[model samples]
Target: MATQLPVINLMGPTASGKTALACELYARGNYELISVDSALVYQDMDIGTAKPTKEEQQLYPHHLIDIITPLEVYSAAEFVTDATALIDQIHARGKTPILVGGTMLYFKALLEGLSDHLPSADIHVRADIEQQAAEQGWESVYAELQRVDPQAAIKFKPSDKQRIIRALEVYRLTGEPITQLQAKQVKNQPYSYAFQNYALLPDRAELHARIELRLQKMWKIGFLNEVEFLMEKYDLNDNLPAARSVGYRQALDFLQKSDRSLKNKAVMEEKSLFATRQLAKRQYTWLRSLQQTHQFNVYLSIEQAQEDLRNLYG
Candidate 1:
């Protein structure tokens, strides 16, 4: 018998007001929030990751928020291990676990195990590949992967060197063609325990507008200063994992320029806003894919979400 209760996932594009709706639902249900976001695990990345403030979090207890250090990297595989344990612990205490966030990989990993598709990256091999990508343009490098893993290469654009390198790295590290290991899930899990999900999905224009407004808010909240502090203290240059994160990339561009000319505030605002919208587009794509298998409903109104939660709990 399955001992765990069904999880209610609240996921959508960034700046979709997931946290606010979650807070409202937490009030009506015997639930604990288990964040599935990749970025929210770190401390001091609060605003860029769209993390709930101390006051908002005080509205309800949260798990997996500050569990990772800024210097260390977290992976979807490890997140699943930790989250499964957290879910079991929460269920044992009689509170349902509400898995929330836009991280589709975390949700996929939790629902189904990591696709054995790719081999783990060997640091030395990856270092060599990164060097190769920089020295010789990514076209030559991806050409190399196209020879071995054409199927994977077909999906990645030539300019997306990061993913190209990952594919080539997998082949070099493990003699297995990385694409060969992709597996289909073996089970259609029955819902024996109570579970429900909601996503606050605004139209594309509204979502884009909200994303733009959010960037302005983050800029005002000292996002540039936070990136500067990381560069100065943590040696977090352009190549670090955290530096490659969404808003941080544009912020780094502002910090590292020689002329120091782009700090017009408006430029940073535009770049941050644009990058955030791009990130949301990718997130929306992932969430739509998951909704096919998971039974999450889209909520246009917070009132409907709250009413459903109250009825579920009572």
Candidate 2:
């Protein structure tokens, strides 16, 4: 019997060259690229997401990109289902699957199954929580989660309003801590794939520089215009995940300002850059945690990753 090829995971923080490496592997033949990004799933979110250009995508196709609109939601559970099916299909076709992107939550859910007991979003419950947040602020909400589920609360900061809300919601629905449920349920079924993980873990200084440069390039390419167009085209609000994306959120704030002066624009740019850096910090934390749990090839430089992968795959 022929041994099934291991699924390769090329993961990193934003602007860490995961996509470039995946494309190179695709060019080598008998491999399919599967994007694990949350933002890249939404259509018309091209520039801010740094989605592959049409030409690049044409040459090296990627599954799970532009699969939904900004108005819709794509949860980590959905990603696990979709990605699992795609992995099976690719393997049956006699090709290795290269799952690549920065969304660690999706990757985590795929590796460790989510709790089936966790309730889905209850509109009324969510509305009540949002109202409370609007009245008492997210700090109050985070405090409440800390009281109810400190294990989960420790993972998120107060500024992480979406996650805080969801954690509290899970508690309200199940009368159990989300962390406990996850730890209990995730062990019931083990994932089947033989995963070969690779993570790009650049130095902090190098990553911050790359983030700043990427944000500047996004602005130069009219990211604000893209946000404006999406706002006009869809019924978007701050609550939507797409609207809350790193660059898009800052761009929306800038567009809503009454004064579009150069000074304010610079301020918006700084805010966006800071938000992106924070995002990279969170990604690094996730990658490091995954590395400890899983067998991962960690690279300090994209050049090093390229050379190693080339020697192994090219």
Q: Which stretches of candidate 2 lie above 4 Å from their native place? A: 1-4, 121-127, 154-157
**CA lDDT for candidate 2:** 0.87
Model 1 Cα lDDT, one tens digit per residue, 1-314: 65546777777778787777677678877889888787888877777887889987888778889886666678776887798788778878987888888887777777656764555445567678878878987778989988999888888898777678778877887765567755433333343444465776677888887788887788788887888877777777665566677888777877786445745556766777787788788877877777888777776655666676567654
Q: In model 2, what are the clashing residue pairs, if there are any?
A: none
Query: Scored by CA lDDT, what does every candidate get?
Result: 0.75, 0.87
Q: For residue 166, give model 2's deviation from the true position in Å.
A: 1.5
Per-residue alpha-carbon lDDT of candidate 2 for residues 136-247, written as tens digits (9 for 90 to 100): 9877888899999998888888888778888898999989998887777764235567888999888889889988888889888888889888989986656677888888
The worst-scoring run of ten residues by lDDT in candidate 2 lies at 184-193
The TM-score of predicted model 2 comes to 0.93
Which prediction has the highest lDDT against the true structure? 2
| Model 1 residue 156 distance off true place after TM-score fit, in angstroms | 2.3
